[model samples]
Target: MGVRLRTAMLAAALLVAGFALRAPFDQLRRYLIARCNDPVRLPRLAEESRVRFQPGARDCAARVAEMLPAALARIEQEQGRPFANPPTVAVYVSYEDYARAGGLGDASVAAVARSGYVLLSPTLCGDESERLAGVLAHELSHSHIFGWRRSWFAARPPSWFTEGLAVMVSGGGGAEGVDEAMAVRAMARGWAITIEDTGLWRDFGAIGFAAEPPPEIFGGDRFAGRQRLAYREAQMFVAWLRRIDPQGFARLLNRVENNESFKDSFVKIYGAGSSRRWSEFLAGVSR
Candidate 1:
């Protein structure tokens, strides 16, 4: 064949391949955009959410309030108890202040004062107000589960379990879909990391906090990877437990919150004492 003809054929083939790839790419883009734009789905609260928005916080507290009842109901049903008190949600726009307060990303931070106030960052509030409500509902679950104890030691929820439970309760149980997808992707890529090694749950004293620089204290690549893994694994494990035994999982969470040992919790809930069950569950899902 002539060189000109050959080059033209090659270009034509490349164009066709590009066109073929476009459909999936577009689909993915649309999916992500939709997810981003969707309202934050939060679990309903027993009481109405009193959201106080900071400047430029995008006033959506009323919308968030409307969505809280359903989310709270789910948690109440799962735990078989009402929240100890009404929740006060505050939305902020300052990343610096949030970091100073020891927050990650745009997160719902529960107070240690037992006041039931949750600090939420606008960036993490999601595209619509509903999405923010969902995030708040998740945070509220942590608050309810832990009471006034802000210490990680107090919660002692396995990284996966706490996060998974939060995801499960948030958005009336639909947020689990996103949680599962992120988790399965992490598991398939062998990126899942144990939370113990990361020391993310460790409590830092005032002196210790002052001694370490902010950058040194907060952002480590290894730690970040592990944190991501923890969130993913927690979601996956929660989903697995729900699938295996919904009632048992709920009972197990309540038991654990009441200071049950991990082994005891597992035994009571799953009728097994070995971590092997978890490993098997992961392996099965990864397949």
Candidate 2:
């Protein structure tokens, strides 16, 4: 074979290897750091439930333990189903350890639902217990979907639906910085992110915030400003659907859990296309 062809083949192989190894690499790093953690068990959580933090972070851990049951209950109550297999919760005592986990791009995130874990930052756990509970519920909502689908190969839901549902079911956990009234006003003025169809790589975080939120929203925190606005907008959309047709919202969750096409499921449950539903939601919020 030509030298050039051999080099091309080698590059392709390396690319594939990198893609396969990235997840395991990050998990291993997180596991190593967790070795020093002190575990806090909650019998009310799922079978594999693990909540742990560094030795000196007991106060934060205790607060998490106290709020955990209520958090899990809130998601189950709102979604009408229990977690198939809840993700383990890992608490970091500081931002340094949280950033070393490697998957998330932004360090401002209070907590994130990973493939099989929820990593919490110190800032989140240090906040008021109520806020911690809300954030915990929001992350668990993602974990519920992760487990119910059973595998990463299952149908990928759109970011709008996933994050929107999380914020809605968690009672505005991720959208705390952006209120419903403000989000509605922004949507009415045509400053909203486009609701796109589900695709493998269509995460909102990856896409970045397209909607221009007001300059004064989160003060100097651009990340929080844009992120919370998108989250609030999506939450409003989902909340509207839930209020308009409770049965349909329930069916939507069922279909989503079963790895069904989201767009098709919306149409089947709502008796109209997703586009129509979007228009209806916008009209109601605007009025």
Candidate 3:
């Protein structure tokens, strides 16, 4: 059987609260942002999306919408939850156009999840739908997390936990793939931060939104000296931990979402030995 197809689908911090978007948009920026974001509605795509376009990328929005069912299903299956609301999706022909139009940045950027919308760029979505699915799934994970965490506390999950889960769920070879390769090469050379190093976990608090947002906030070495590698390591750690103990994963996230400290939450579910387990996992990966 050919089967059926369906379609669907922030930022960090205020990206979580999404609606509180600092009104950083000036006349031109606001206009452009609104153009893509509040696009005139097109016919509904599959079960979820009503494709929207900003004259420049109608095809891009349609392309992503065409792939939404698989992406949403993956998120639901991985997270063990369904979305409370369908995410608003805006597609740009390429990242460069999106940045220029929205005052965001170049085509290197793929998508951003906001409180109410998922902004996408087809620039790197590749030629095939299958290739693009991973990116869609990854961005959708962020949207899902942003929505789910609000009921517990305003605070967002640590960068590692959030980004790690997104990468883990995405079948695409995202930054995690690069992170893994980098870790392996680094490990071979006997260079890796200890699992116990707190730096391994990203602190979102240190990021200052002094201006709209620089490229570093999205990805790069701006946060920590080893920030990129730390992200990869964090993804590996969290994903593996979840695999070994899903019940613990659920409980740990529940506690953390409600503002529990990572160590406290880890012990509450997996016993104090959880830290030992983490160190062991780290050693194996680095070895």
Q: What TM-score against the true fold does each predicted structure earn?
A: 0.59, 0.78, 0.64
lDDT of each: 0.53, 0.73, 0.57
Q: Quick one: best TM-score, which candidate?
A: 2
Question: Which of the two candidates, 1 or 2, achieves a greater lDDT against the reference?
Answer: 2
Residue by residue across 208-273, what tens digits does model 1's lDDT show? 111222233224543433443455566566677778887887677667667666566777678775
- The 10 consecutive residues of candidate 2 with the worst lDDT sum are 38-47
Which one wins by lDDT: 2 or 3? 2
Lowest-lDDT window of 10 residues in candidate 1? 204-213
Q: Count clashes in each candidate, considering only residues at least 3 apart in sequence or on different chains.
A: 16, 0, 6
lDDT of 2 by residue, 1-287 (tens): 99999999999999999988887786565655544432333222322236766656666767777777788888888888888876577777667667655245345778877656777777876664457877888899988876788655666878888888999988888878689888777777778766765744323343234466667756898777778888888887888888889988999988898888888888788888766788778777677
Model 3 lDDT vs. the true structure? Answer: 0.57
For residues 1-287, what per-residue lDDT tens digits would candidate 3 score against the true structure?
22232221112444545544443334336456646644334334444454455565555666777777778888888777787567777665545555654334434455656555676666544443344667677778877866655643344545656666777888532453355766556544554334431212123312111122234433544333244454455567777888888988988766654455666667677775544876677667766
Q: Is candidate 1 or candidate 2 better by TM-score?
A: 2
Model 2: how far residue 280 lies from native, Å: 1.7
Off by over 4 Å in 1: 1-49, 55-58, 100-115, 125-130, 148-155, 171-182, 195-229
